[model samples]
Target: MTADRLQPVLAGVMLALVGFASSFAVVLAGLQAVGATSEQAASGLLALLIAQAVGVIWLSRRHRIPLVLAWSTPGAALLVSSGAVEGGWRAAVGAFLVVGALILLTALWPRLGDLIAAIPTPIAQAMLAGVLLSICVEPVRVLLDRPFLVAPILVVWVVLLRVAPKLAVPGAFVATLVVITGYLVDHGAPDLSLAPQVVWTEPTLNWQAVVGLAVPLYVVTMASQNVPGVAVLATFGYRVPWRESMTVTGLGTAAGAMAGGHAVNLAAITAAMAASPESHPDRDRRWIAAYTSGWAYLVLAAVSTALVGVVSAAPHGLVEVVAGLALLGTLGGALKGATESETGREAAVVTFVVAASGVAFGGVGAAFWALLAGLVVHGVLKLGRPSAPRM
Candidate 1:
């Protein structure tokens, strides 16, 4: 088990970097949108890291589950949008607590977990595809805007993913860094500066924010994000306890929220690296990798907004193009897998359309709609049993 976990420990660091880069912007922006000073935001992000590490390590060790935790990208987006309407750190904290409570409560309901499992694999896959489609689209937009700059790298990435799947993601990141370096050589990139005085804001409580932001945060994090996250684990042959994992997610977010961070949840994309054969063949050993990732997250969280200062210095389009291209294979596979089966194909289509529709109500995201629609359709189809031919 020790040897099995060692290689994954290395890969886990890469996965953490990927997860951090993909969603840190949302964290920063959401914190700022909710009125956290640069320093307080940094502290909040650190708190988030602590929560994630504790959740992943404890849950993985206890359940031998290889669990991985991350802040919800969609939930962050929702929080930022919510902040736009319900401004202030107090509101954000209120929303965070509300969502945390909901996640914890949801975990208590065994039937809910069973219902989530009942979602046809194909339909769930379609929802995954729909959610990721936007991510995949960014590389093309980058190509159109700066074809001379991003095209060659995009081509190389796609080819590598097809021919050498294992190196696909890292290769893309390396290629983008090279391009970004070249761009910086000719045109100086943005300046990097540490915050003069770290800003910290005390959290306040607000009932309206709880309704407008908190509930939505929980719904989006769980229904849209965590559900598929578990599917990924199952797909890889890991049988994790849903309730326990959900509890960790809830507690993690709650801790982060107390420090002024928003929703956190199980990581789907980064989980693949740990779960994959490249990480470890012995499933039992993968926990070490998750353990290591939690530690790395703590370091990043401690560094706070300074980390953002460094990332902000890089070319934005470069990162987006690279990240999007890197995810292409995974997204394509997910989308294709979701729509492949005939039995769940139509439901899958509806799930995808509704999820990608960008609808929102009272801070809830499009995913809630998608999941709700899929469930209704799935339930109706299941219930509408044809009368047995008159015997």
Candidate 2:
């Protein structure tokens, strides 16, 4: 292949590598937090990878745009914060299905999509920031608990942050693998099955989980991932097929939910990487990069269970160190988005504190409460303010 063609392939591989390595731990943690067992969590990861791969390849090829999809990172953080709801894991799966239905509903009813978009950016971002804070602190908590064991991963992460920002998290993950190997050498490796695996959970809807988990998950996925994805592509002069994109992601999420996957949505952070001039000078050809990424995800999916087995073998949820490292960047950006606007600062703080407190009532999670509390504060503060006089 010519260099023009080969460059996109490489870019595609790098995108998949960075995307998967940086956030797989978060996905695993999120699934487990909502009561998924190791097998189920691994299946969720597998389902998400396969769904994302199929979505990216199909959309990129059909639209001739570098349309990329990813498992919901912010949504995963929300799940970690939410923990298990009243009905446990099955309820969570049911909520996942509802989120997919909501996405699809929005696609068919533009007004529903508009209502979601109409939610003030500050409010949405503030809630997300609050939900992310707990997960972001995992590295520090892990370090304090076992200083020597976690230090090397952070060191590798810090070293790479200056040298290669994109590879920083992946580098930390590599350090984690080394640490895992050392432990395994000291105590012989556990028996691991290499055979393909899938675990299906029947959806059991519970109102509490729907309110606490589904609502927050759908909002986060849309606000943080799908919306930004559209903007990212637009910046590169590409118009995403909004309906088709939603249809694919919504259906994919629904299908994957039965197998423990939470949600899949449009790519945000990595969308720019694949569509930018860095991928290719010719705009028309950039889709090749995203197309190649789909294949890369399929390959990664094949090894998903094996990685899960190794990480599960590690002591004290050691992947938290790397997962925390991966999320710090996202937390910083979310905080900036939350606090940037002077008008919403008070409401944002209220939301942040409530979410960080991890409070729940009536079996609902803090994420839903945080958003509601912020809105109430935001609205109350606005009640008597002088309106812009006939601007």
Candidate 3:
């Protein structure tokens, strides 16, 4: 391949690793939080990553577009919260399948697609802000618990993000590794033996799980994860096929869920690296970067169980702080974009507030609720408004 082509491939690999490094722990914790044995969770995430790799490869190769897929970060948070309430991987799997079916239906049904499209962007933004708010909280809490280890790393991160544009996330990752290593040696961290082996779990599909878990999983993944993901692509001037992307994401999530992973979808943060000019000057070449990143994700997932134990040996607060700080930019941008419009601002705020309220009505998550509320408010506001001027 020419040097032009080679650059994106390399960039994608690096970006993908950074993306995984930031959020992989949350994925592990989500599974463990929801009653997955460390073994089952690892297997499931490996499955998710493998499926994601396949999807990313096929999609990028076929479309020649920079399409990157991964487990849903928002869905991970939802899994962490609802998994705690729902009990067992069975429920989580059922939810995953339901979400997949819904996405498939969205692809199949033009009317539903239009309806989903009708949702104002601001409301979607509001819900996104709400869903992300919870993730931001954990790192702050961790910082409070372990200031010595996390604070300096956070300082380095903020300064780097401001001072060195390209190196922000990667710099944070390096800083985290150094701090974690020092802490481990200084504190005499335990020697944990974890084998990087696959442990498959038999999937059980139940009505309660389907209704309670699956549908909600689909809603949250689509509403919270997929929507902004597409927006990011559009914002970056890539006219990617949304339906096709959703299909890949749906299938990937289904495959992952069957293997005990929560819900895999398009990655927002990782996508940024590939999408941004930092990855490569030519936008077309970024697809190679995304493809390489998918390969790396598969490798990491394959070894996730063993790696989890090794990583867990580090001071927990350090990882949390780094991940959070790395995400601060993305979160701030999402918040701003979600509230930029006058017409949709109020509904968006409602969406954010309702979603952030953490109320689960009829098995749906905060993302769905936020969007739902925002839609209703937006509609009411529209009807209440004087008619638009004729051209």
Q: Where does candidate 3 clash, by residue pair?
A: 8-289, 12-289, 95-213, 95-214, 99-218
Candidate 1 per-residue lDDT over residues 1-391, each given as its tens digit: 5664468778778777767755665566557655666566676777777788778878777876667898876665444433443446766766677778778877888675566556677666665556566656777887888888787777767787789865666666666656766776788866645542234345556655665566546655765578778878899888768788878888777766767667778888788777877777777777667777887786666665566554345555655565455446656776777777776677788888876665656555555567668878877876785756986
After superposing candidate 1 on the true structure, give the runs of residues whose Cα lies further than 4 Å from its correct spot: 1-47, 61-65, 73-94, 118-128, 177-242, 258-262, 267-286, 302-307, 313-319, 326-330, 359-365, 372-391
For residues 1-391, write the lDDT of model 2, one tens digit per residue: 9898899999999999989999999999999999999899999999999999999999999999999999999999899989989998999999999999999997888787787888777788888888888888888998988888799988989999999988999999989999998999999999976654899999998899999999999999998999899999999999999999999999999999999899999998789999998888999999999999999999999999999999988988587777778888888888888899898788888888888889999999999999899889999988957888785
Tens-place lDDT digits, model 3, residues 45-74: 677778788888888788877777878766
lDDT of 3: 0.69
Give me the candidate number with maximum lDDT: 2
TM-score of each: 0.72, 0.98, 0.83
Q: Point out the worst 10-residue segment of candidate 2 by lDDT.
A: 316-325
Candidates' C-alpha lDDT: 0.68, 0.91, 0.69
Total backbone clashes of candidate 3, pairs 3 or more residues apart or in separate chains: 5
| Model 3 ranges with Cα > 4 A deviation | 1-5, 81-83, 186-194, 202-217, 223-244, 267-269, 272-286, 314-319, 360-368, 389-391
Q: Using TM-score, give the best candidate's number.
A: 2
